[model samples]
Target: MLGLMQDWPLRLHRLIDHAARHHGARPIVSRSVEGPVHRTDYAAIHRRSLALAQRLAREGVKPGDRVATMAWNTWRHIEAWYGITGAGAIYHTLNPRLFPDQIAWILNHAESRLMFCDLSFLKLLEGLAPKLPHILRFIVLTGPETMPETSLPGAVDYESWLAEADGDFEWVAGEENAAAGLCYTSGTTGEPKGVLYSHRSNVIHALACNAPDMLGLSATDRVMPVVPMFHANGWCLPFIAPLSGASLVLPGPKLDGESLQSLMQAEGVTFTAAVPTVWLGLLQYLEASSAPLSTLKRVVIGGSACPRALTAAFERRGVHVVHAWGMTETSPIGTICGVKPEVAGRDAEGTLDLQETQGFPPFTVDMRIVGDDGAEKPWDGTTFGNLQVRGPTVTRGYFKAERDALTPDGWFETGDVATIDPAGYMHITDRTKDVIKSGGEWISSIELENLAMGHPDVAEAAVVAARHPKWDERPLLVVVPKAGREVSRDSLLAHLAPQVAKWWLPDDVVVVAEIPHTATGKILKTKLREQFAGYFGVP
Candidate 1:
């Protein structure tokens, strides 16, 4: 006999409706570009979203049509997101940090019909407007008082456009499998490929993320997602927070340590998520300032591994740091290194060590490590292999690209070399492309990078494989030293000597002013590879 559970169709609009009905008064706060904090509630957001939906429909946005948004994390951006999706249109978030050519290419590739952006990006939009053939209209997310007169005509103020719209509208109903949003991967190699998220996938991902074991979001929690809305929907916190009726604090265009710290204190934020660079700034700011994060309870660090020092600092301050691992393909949450019940009583050092791992898979995710011969490896934490995952949230295939990336059995190759312990904990050793092979032995650049970051003088580090005639390839360490701190190559190399295998140590160390990074805050090793391609051995 079938179970008596309700057969509910998961959809994005349903989540918004639930929040509006049950948690209408919950606050969704944002720090705007004008240096003022703007506060709204779920009811207002829902009403504005409906108005936005009506405006989008009037702008010729048909079902499944792509509506591109190039804006920061703000209440209006969130409204635009739900509004576009609620009207049966696809919401495509354009990363502003990408090159103009890449942005133009994505806009054309996605066939976006309507473009909504913040007033801050007027110059950027004007520069690339000539190349975006698919974008028929431009709507600035600002009032008429601040709308600038630019060479690119036909721009409409967001408030004025929505004023002519009506909020008394019904959400367009469609199949749960209908495409809801599209996000392009950071194109390190070829042109960026798109990951189309279905309404069902998004809703499920949001629900899974809200569970007590995962992010454990609630209406009582105040969240500040320092991760930009352009990056994997700020790791899906925007949707999950509103759905859970949590108070959201969005830092728009101002991610500096002072600004973020002030907002966190002012809003009494309990949870926040961002990449390592942003946290580094906050940690440094906290170290110098006497301000206490009185309400902060959890910090989610992803996009890169969190430094051990940073994790320890937060833990000492009574804030839990959950190191997460995922990509643009996995709805950006594969593993969250939360404290398991079994290890809850472990000593501070031991617990911190476990927290440093990539963590175990969440409820909806399944992970496995495959050897070169395609055989699954034992979970001993010593046998490193290529990581593969299959889940409800993982992308099945790239939009309009070859399906070869997906396995016959439906797993997506994560391209990360990792180890899974018997306890089901996964630790990423390195990316397949980033793994350095010397004399037929694999060297994990991630391990080296982590070790380098542990040095007090080193602020940032990236390890890239350099060509070597003797042993196929070798590693070159690029480091960004702490401000006003001096570090020599020998001293930094010595710091790692006792921490790693002898051969795994970097072959050469190069100090640089700064390490290049992708738009999503990941170190751009692809560019580093090109910069030092000719240096086969010690230069």
Candidate 2:
């Protein structure tokens, strides 16, 4: 016997409606791409989103149609999301950092009918316009004055476009599972594949991430999403913040240490989320300037492994660091490193160790590990295997792909090797292709990279396998030292020798002025492997 509940559908428009009614006056601040700040609230956003939705309908957007957005984490972009999705159209966000060829490929592949772009990216769009014939119109995310002259067809200013329509509009209703947004991977290995997000999936993901053990966000908190909207929907904070009625301070395109520091203090930001690299820069800046994290209370670190040293630095200053883990396929929020009640009796070190691992899976997600012979592995805390997951928010297949990328038993292979403790805490060891194999022993490059980062002189480190005559593959260390500081290979090796297993020691250490990174700030190990493929081969 099933109890009946409200037949109301879970959609994106309701989040803004609830926020506007309850938290109408809460501040939503943004440093506009035009070199000024813009401020609005839930009520204004709700009214403007309705106007924008009407405009979208007038522009011929229909249900299931794809409308792309190439803008930063600003007020306008946030409005576009609710407006586009509310009008029964999928909002496709394009990452301008990608190669022009890649941009054209995705635009054509998605068949985006209309694109909302920032003024900063007009030149890129102009150059890419001729190739993306699928895109019917381009709306620059600017006013008439700031709008640059372009050769594209039907180009118009954002303000003028929205002004053409009145704010009298209601959202178009549909099934809960209708596609509302489209995000693609960074295309590190091959052509980027799209992950289509649904209204139900995204709404459920936002609720799960808001649980006490997860983000723990409340209406009283102020959030700063340093992660770009192009990166997995800014880890879904754009949705989570509104649902929780939290004030937001978007940092526009300036994510440097100093710029972020100013926003954190000026806005009284209680919580923020960003990649490990961003926090590293902030910590370095704070150390150099001797400034305290005045108003910032907690930080959620993801995109890559959060190094121990980085967390340790923040812990010293009373700022809590939450190591988050997710992928584009998981609606970008799978696990958050929150301390469990079972860990209460453990010593401080024991608690810290558990907190360092990627925390337990949220209630909505399911996780398991499998071995090469197609068997589930034990959650013994030490047994590492291929990680697989399935949930309402996880993608079952890629967009437009001919086949599903899942195991026969219906689990999506995460391509990551990990271990889960008896208490259900998961720890990522390495990617399947990144784990170094030497003399029948498996070595985790991620572990070594973290260890190397502990060195005072080592600013960034990446561990890749190099061919060796004796051992089939040996670890090679690529180091990027802190600016103006000299790094010595021998000293770094000595520093790491006692920390890790002797066999895991790097074969050699070489310094590079800078390291290559993907658009999402992950170390591009693929490029590094190709560049250093013959380090051992060389005489």
Candidate 3:
């Protein structure tokens, strides 16, 4: 039976339109890369986006063409997203932190016709311009005065280019499921694969993110995304903020603790989201400064396992911490760990233990864990297995791949080993390849890493499986001490011994000046494993 409805297409442009019409005066603040803080409103963003769309059409960008942006999380970058999508083009975001070869490969593979980059990446673009023959033009995300001289062909400043046309054209209308954005994986395992996002999926994901159980954003709230736009469309905050009429604060190139704290304090930011490393820096800064988080209310931490100590530090300051878990394939928001009423009834320590788990999924997503035999594992909180997910926002396959990236039963393999409690809370144990098998029992590297991060003297920590003659493979702990504080192997071992099984304790502890990390800020355990390949005297 067909139902009568308006049949409005779920397009990305409509999000900006709704915001402009209903919350036109809402602020979109930015710490501009050009050495000053800039501010604008949703109405101005909508109008400029439309103008940029018209300019793109004049420049011969057709529907389905890919346009790339290697910029930070600023107002201009946000405008480019709406503008490119409004012109029916795919907005491909390139992470500037990635190596030049990887960036060139991604650009060539995507066949990006044009690129909108921040001034900071001009030299990078110039170096890769030869390899990126498909990119016809380079639009620097800056004004004419601040635009630096570049040798790349057909380059221009974004503000000047956007001024070429009036915002009189309407957004292109078509199938809601058409591709609107592209984000590549961090490629820790292999060559990076693209996760193509559709307008329909993104719109649905925004609604889920704005829900109370998720980010719980509202018009009165002011939000900041320390994560960059290149990371899963800034974890969909570019859409989530406007859709909820929440004012946004975009921190430019400066992500250090002092800069972020200053911006948040100045903007009266009430909500923010980033990885644990970011918060760790901020917490350390607060510990030294004794700064009061006067207006900050909540924070969402993800991208890796957040230590419970970090959560306690925020809660101690009256700031709520929401531990979330997701990847590029799931539109980057699979599960959020907000406390449930039933779990809230427990003691404070017990509740913090539950919060340590990546919380349950929103109604749109479904999750399950499977064993090596391809059978479903019981959600008893103790048994861990391969995590799989199926949802509208989840990717069924990688872009341009010949085969589906899913199981025969149609669930996307998350590449993470996890356990789900009977109450529906999901906890990540470790990556499938990183989990240690010692004496026929599995040991969780993530668990040990998180515990190590709880130590006051530890700045960063990682656990890797080391080859052992006795157990075949045993856990090895490597840590980086906080500045000005010295950490010892014995002290770290003693701190961890009381919390976990004796066998789960690391065989040895090594202190290092620093740990290598992936472009996305995750610990590069692959490199660590290679560095300590024979740590247990096994050759």
Candidate 4:
């Protein structure tokens, strides 16, 4: 028999409601694309969101309709998320960094009726207008003064549209399992697939990610998410900030190192999250200028592995670095590396080593690794296998796929190969397809790349499997040297000699001016493999 208790459903709108009711004056700051920083409070955000919902309803935006947005992280985009969801519609974020054809295809695939875009993408949208016939309207996210003349149909300024409503309407209520948001993968493996998120899943993910051992956020902190809103819902920071009553800062379209450092310092931001590449730029700028990040207390790095040198650099400056791991399919927050009680006694060096791992999951998510025979591997820190995960927030299937993307036993196969230590820290070795094979043994390219990044002269590093005749396959190191620094092959190899097994060493080193990357700032190894496929004279 089920226990008797309150049956109130947990919905996404309640997060905004909680912030508006209790933390009304908490600031929601943003750098506007029009050339200045703008500030608004939760109370104003709540009121404007209600106005937006009313406007949507009046325009015949029915429940379950897909509303598209192609804007940066700003106050307007944040309001659109809640407003669209409150009107019982799904918000689909279109990544501007994606190819124009892909963006058009995604818009048509999702059947988005109305779109809200920034002024910078106006020309882009105009160029793709011929390909996107299903889009009925284009609402520019700006005021009358900054709005530009556009050729798209049914175009209007956001301020004019939002001013039509007085926020007199209440949020439309529905089941917790209704679709709320849509995010597509980077399509590295194949065609981009959409991961539909439900209201219950989004709310649950925010709750789990806000725990003490997870992000550990509090109301008194100022938070910034350098990650884009169009990417995995800005890594869920939009929701986490409001749910915890933290002041949110959006960097707008200016993500350069100097701009970011200036914003963080001016706002007194204490917590922030972004990929490793962003931090590398900031560190470079700080080294050149000798600037201090006096207000930053912690930074959570993801999107790619955090180099050990990068982590140590931040720690040396008295800022904590957290290595998190997740994908669009996992609501983008499967694990966060917060220190646990059992490993608290370690010294500084040991702690940094442990922090390099992806860390364990919260109770909401489950993780495991299995070998070729479908047997669970031991948590010995050295035995690596195919990583698998399953949880309430994890996607059971793609948005419109014919079949579920799960194994016969119902676990989602993450493309990564990893090992779980005895203390439950999970460390990723390599992707299943990217792992190199020498003779019959497996070698992790990620391991070699991470070691290469520690070199003082190396600015960036990548490893790919180059075909070898004698060994079947071997690892090749590709590096981009720092400006005006001479990084020779012998010196890098000598630096890595003592720390790793001799067999795991790269067969050769190749220097390049730059490496190609995906739209999400990840190394595009497919291109690297093709470029150096015959480096060893293998047929």
Candidate 5:
């Protein structure tokens, strides 16, 4: 017999409606491309989103259709997201940093019916519009007065459409399992596969993030998510903020050190999240300018491992640093490494060490590690294995039934090799694809990369396998030094002497001007493999 419970449907529209009805005056600020700030509130967003939904429905968009957006982290983009999904259409976010061909491929593959793009991407859209046969309309997210004339003949202004519509459209009632959003993976190995998110999954993920032990969001918190909205729904902050009634500050395209710092200071932001690369820049700016990070309290770093030094630097300044881990398929938040209550009073260094792990799985997630032999390992922190997970927020399968993406047992393989301690904390060693194999022994490239990043002169580092005549394959170090800093091969290798095992040490270190990255800010190891494929060992 089922226990009686509230007949609540996890709908995306309810998030916006809740915010509008309860916290209408909360600020939603965004930086514009024209070097100015535009501010609004939950009330305005709700009204505009309703108008957008009505416009979409009037334009022949129906349930189960796909509406794509290739825009920055701005208010308009957020409206389009909720509006399209609220109208019972799937909201597909296209990463603008992807190659034009990849963008065209995703749009056509998703069979997007309409696209809303930023005005700054006019030229790029014009170049790619001809190839996107499925896209029938191109709506520029700009006002009629400022909309630039482009070669695309059928383009329309966003403000004009909103003005011509009414904010009285009712949210279409769809099943909780119905697809709400589609995000494609960066496709390091093959063509990018689509991860379809449902309204139930997205809403549940937002509620899970609101827990104090997790993201600890509140109405008083001013959040600045430097992660782009196109990237896993900005780690789901767009949905979480509205659900929690927190004030949001979107940095838009200006994610540079100085600009972000200024916005943080001006807006009195208390919590923020971004990749480690962004924090590195902000730390550099703070050090050089002697600027005080006055209002900032916590920083959540993901997309890559947070270097120990970076975490320590922020903690030294009295700021809490949380190292989270997840992928597009996990609705982006599987684990958040915050200090447990029992260890709250521990020594500073010990607590910092705990913060470096990916932390325990979030409330809605369940994690397990399986060895190469398919044996389940104990949470001893030493037994490294393939990480597999199942949760309410995790995607069961890709859009349109991609059978190979899911396992027969129903667990999603995260492609990460990791360890979980008895205390329930998880630590990722490396991606299965990036793990180095020498004489059948696995070497963690992520560990080596993190160790290399500890060196003072090393700005960033990536580790990939280089071919070896005797061992078959060994680790290769690709280093990018800080500006105007010099680090010799000997000094760099010497720094790693005491940190990692001798076998894990790189055979050679190659300094590069910059490391290539994927659209989601991950190191492009595939590119590294291609560039040094033949650099095995000398005869």
Candidate 6:
């Protein structure tokens, strides 16, 4: 009963092809590490990517070989991304912020044969370059003038390497299920494991994110993705932006407040996406400068819960903060903060409250919360349980893992505890490991942090479990106050008393200058627990 339709497979290279054909003039702006802003177009990127593919082929890069990139978010990185995949090789984005040993370990584990890195990260990789015996060549993403001398086995300037070939080649089309990209997690829970994304999954994720009700991107928008390409495929931005024909503004190495604001002004960026900490930094810069993001409309914040104060700050400037939720395993976008049709009629205050939740699952995703006994939980928004999902873009297992990570009935257990509302909105309670147990009860660390962030003086906050004599474990409030702002423990506790159950209040408050963060900008609660595990005198 097969239908007589064309069986053409969807590949990511065709996305760039489409952009070049239709939106060739759309600009791709990058503040390259070479110290200047380089502006190119979709047509230019496509032609250059073709040259890159040809050059890779000439360099003996074979299909299914691993090609690594240790660079920032820039046009050259995008070019490498497509060229590597276009040549039917997997694109492994190496995070430079990770520990150097971890980077070396990941590169060895993936057996990466070649690498494309920015000049800035060359020194960081120098110490481990000799150890990566599998790597055949290293193409520095810079011109010959700026390329530094390195001890990498086989190194060349990218411009010279690309010049070896012209944009006179066709992309090698592989099966849709062929691995196209690889990203490892932040290893907050354990060692970083690789998640291989097929061409099909990446193509599908781009389609889903650009849907009208999702990110709702179009050709007219000027998009800027501040999230690094090394992290979760840059949340699939490198694909989605080109597919939508939107002009791009890639914020390379300088993600500081002044640098970002300057780029936004120069480029007239209309839409952007990043984690909460990034937005917090931008907002602080704006507040300090008394500036306005005139052309910016909406910002998608994820990687951590969007603080209520941060959301309100953006709203005050007539911008919308879309609270998103995802992990590296979900192809990074499971849910976004857009209202469903049923809940669209709520009042302003009610709408604000609704947006604070993680919103509903998008079209391709299926979600459910399961109780301790493995039964489906009620959708009352009050009963929290283990969140599980199954989707086309979801990974069935790690890259080389032995076992399939799925329930017997076929759902992947997301390590989050979430509650779904009757209206179908999902609210994340906390990570399984971060939830506190007190005298046979559970408390959500996310909820406590959200409430604590509402206080005026508290710039940042994290709640972790500490041993207690009677309850086995109790909550500890770790606060980082605003610069030069006085914060008393009594006031912060008073603010939380009315919002949550009295028993759920933190045992004590400790002030610190700064909080440790993961490469993705999430609070490293594991570190916090390790540092303060015995606060209540446990072994």
Q: RMSDs, each prediction?
A: 1.7, 1.4, 0.8, 1.0, 1.6, 1.1
Error of 2 at 394 (Å): 0.4
Q: Single out the weakest 10-residue window by summed lDDT for candidate 5.
A: 399-408
lDDT of 5: 0.88
Candidate 6 Cα outliers beyond 4 Å, as residue runs: none
Order of quality (lDDT): 3, 4, 2, 6, 5, 1
- For model 2, the stretches where C-alpha displacement exceeds 4 angstroms are 345-351
For all candidates, the clash counts are: 0, 0, 0, 0, 0, 0
Candidate 3 residue lDDT tens string, 49-84: 999999999999999999999999999999999999
Residues 1-539, model 6: lDDT tens digits? 99999987888898999999999999999999987999999999999999999989988888899999999999999999999999999999988888888888889989999999998887887888878989989999999999888987788999988998977899997899999999998776667899999999999999987787789889999999999998888988889988999999999999988889899988999889998888878877997898668998889888888878888888888888888888888898999888678888888668778877988767778899998778999999899999999998888999789998899998989889999999888999899888998999999898899889999898899999999888999999999998789788899999999989999999999999999998778899999999889998885
Model 4 spans > 4 angstroms off: none
Q: What C-alpha lDDT values do all the predictions have?
A: 0.88, 0.90, 0.92, 0.92, 0.88, 0.89
Q: Each model's TM-score, in the order given?
A: 0.97, 0.98, 0.99, 0.99, 0.97, 0.98
Index of the highest-lDDT prediction: 3
Give the Å error, residue 247, model 2.
0.6
Give the alpha carbon lDDT tens digit for every residue of 1-539 in model 4: 99799887777899999999999999989999997999999999999999999999999999899999999889999999999999999999999888888899889889899999999899999999989988999999999998889998899999999999999999998999999999999887677889999999999999999999899888999999999988886888999999999999899999888989999999999999998888888999998898778999999999888999999999999999999999999988989998989889899999988988999997789999999777899999999999999999999999889999998888899999999999899999999989998999999888888889999999899999989989989989999998889899999999889988898888889999998888888899998999998999996
List the candidate 3 regions with Cα displacement exceeding 4 Å.
none
The true-versus-predicted C-alpha distance at residue 109 of model 4, in Å, is 1.4
Give lDDT: candidate 1, residue 134.
Answer: 79
Which is better, 2 or 3, measured by TM-score?
A: 3
Candidates, ranked, TM-score: 3, 4, 6, 2, 5, 1
The reply for model 1, stretches above 4 Å from the true place, is 1-8, 402-404, 536-539
Model 1 TM: 0.97
In candidate 5, position 363 carries an lDDT of 79
